[model samples]
Target: METALIEYGNFLVAGVTVNATESTDFAAVWDELLERVSDEQKTATAKLQKVGVLMPDAADEGFTYTAGFIVQGIPAVAALGLTGVVVPAAMYATVLVEGPAADSIKPGFEYLHSTFIPEKDVTPTGVNLEVYGPGDVTASNYRMYCWSAVDGVESPI
Candidate 1:
């Protein structure tokens, strides 16, 4: 489990995401969101990524369920106009998750939030990010690389 700290610029993302744990169909939601952005001719230079604490409902108020965050070349101003969401800029800690993106990724996140964070004695300084790489063709198989920023030095939790 290798970890690294990196700086990411601002970007825009439009997606239909739910806060509750009612077994959401993320694939469908992601497709819809991508379509909407495409229709608007939103040229996304930054790839799609997911970020948030594992079992967010169990975390404190600020921490919660999975939230989608995209990193694009567009600046904050332009991104806000396009996505209608205020995205804050900051550093991030990145970690790669191998295997299927469905349930497997959740365990990785859980480890980060529950075990790694406390073990490392670090707190999230900026928005969490999950970089989705190749292998997401099927529901049962995919790869997701996660990123979460922390104060001082950003490292994998």
Candidate 2:
């Protein structure tokens, strides 16, 4: 496993908060979220790489899932039915996850939270990002980059 550290800023994204758990039908949720993001992008004639952000719920073990895309500027949050999220400037451990979106995401995150951060000398800030790359996105050969905020400059191998 190879890694890169990057300092990324916050973003305004159009998304919905879903109660997601281990048994959730993730594929369905992702399909709708991706489609919604696509529609929002088309309607605005704006574009950016789509992302699925997993934020831990304060009340439950499940996550508050936000599926959307990053906007260059502040988006019309209310008008577009999108919530503004400040990604906050932070360092991240980036890893490439390539394969079908459905299959790749779960294990990718598992590695990040379970193995990557613990094995490296970094602290998880709890904000994780799933960056979708430009390609035949849903295909088995698709590509994505998973980034997790950390507190140190430790090498993420």
Candidate 3:
């Protein structure tokens, strides 16, 4: 329900992603992700999301995306065997997602991409972010911040 221009520093994430353009249940993807995370994982942030956008006119069945925690290094999470992705510093149109990790998470991104981005007249960098709190997936007390990668997008909302 809030909007702002936020800056993030580089961090490592070992996780997964789905081409949002494809027909997929994003919530289930996150559930599968939870199983892959190592028990000893250390996170730089409570939670975060990273996505790669495909270029227009690009040849592909779907777009590219990545999701995971903010970690110190890829080696730190090498045990998980997940492909590591580094989130770089950039300004993003950020929004907060409330409720359960399995439920609140997906829609948060949807709001930013479907409503926030276009409303701002800004092109998504294709690097999306989601911030999560301590614990596993559920419908209890969980918080996540969904961020859209954007460059110099101004908002009046």
Candidate 4:
């Protein structure tokens, strides 16, 4: 349960975006998105790493989910039928979730919101990031870093 405070730079991401609620099945959503972009992703240049951007929905209890890949610059998403998101630079509290991603994300998030953030006394900026690098995602030791944006440092949102 180690947590770290770090600075994240603004970056560009391109992927499938969907409005998700508490009842939504994340695995299904990701599978659908992957099916839509699998081919392009294999050939896409400058595509850095996989990422999941969670932007809180002020109008609902859920968040806007963007299953994407960080790109070196503006990505040509029009042809892929994907949306481009500009993740603003901000300070974040991060936790490394180790294990199969499907099984670890929820618990990781719970820890962040329930214990870590409260202990640090930082206000979440309503934006969260899940970063994944190249690896065997199904491996038991797979890792994903969850970053929660927090107030205090100046951000260019």
The lDDT leader among the candidates is 4
Per-residue alpha-carbon lDDT of model 1 for 1-157, expressed as tens digits?
6555566655554333445443665555556555545433444423445443222333544332333445454464255333323345556556667776766656665666676555666787535655666444345556677766556554334
Cα TM-score of candidate 3: 0.65
Please provide, for model 3 over 52-118, each residue's C-alpha lDDT reduced to its tens digit, 9 standing for 90 to 100.
Answer: 3222223544455555555567674576666676666667878877788667756877888888878
Decide which is better by lDDT, 3 or 4: 4
Worst 10 residues of 4 by lDDT: 38-47
The clash numbers for all candidates, in the given order, read 2, 1, 6, 0
Report every candidate's CA lDDT.
0.52, 0.72, 0.62, 0.78
Estimate the TM-score for candidate 2. Answer: 0.78
Clashing pairs in 1: 50-130, 93-148
TM-score of 1: 0.57
Model 4 spans with C-alpha error above 4 angstroms? 38-40, 45-47, 58-61, 153-157
C-alpha RMSD in Å of predicted model 3 compared with the true structure: 5.0
Local error of candidate 2 at residue 138 (angstroms): 3.0
lDDT digits (tens) for residues 1-157 of candidate 4: 7788788789887787789875777677667778877575667632568888898766857788888777655536655667888888888988999998878888888888888888878888889888775687778999888888988655445
Runs in model 3 lying further than 4 Å from the true structure = 17-21, 37-61, 118-121, 135-137, 153-157
lDDT of 2 by residue, 85-129 (tens): 656667887888988877887788788878887887788877788
Backbone clashes (count) for model 2:
1
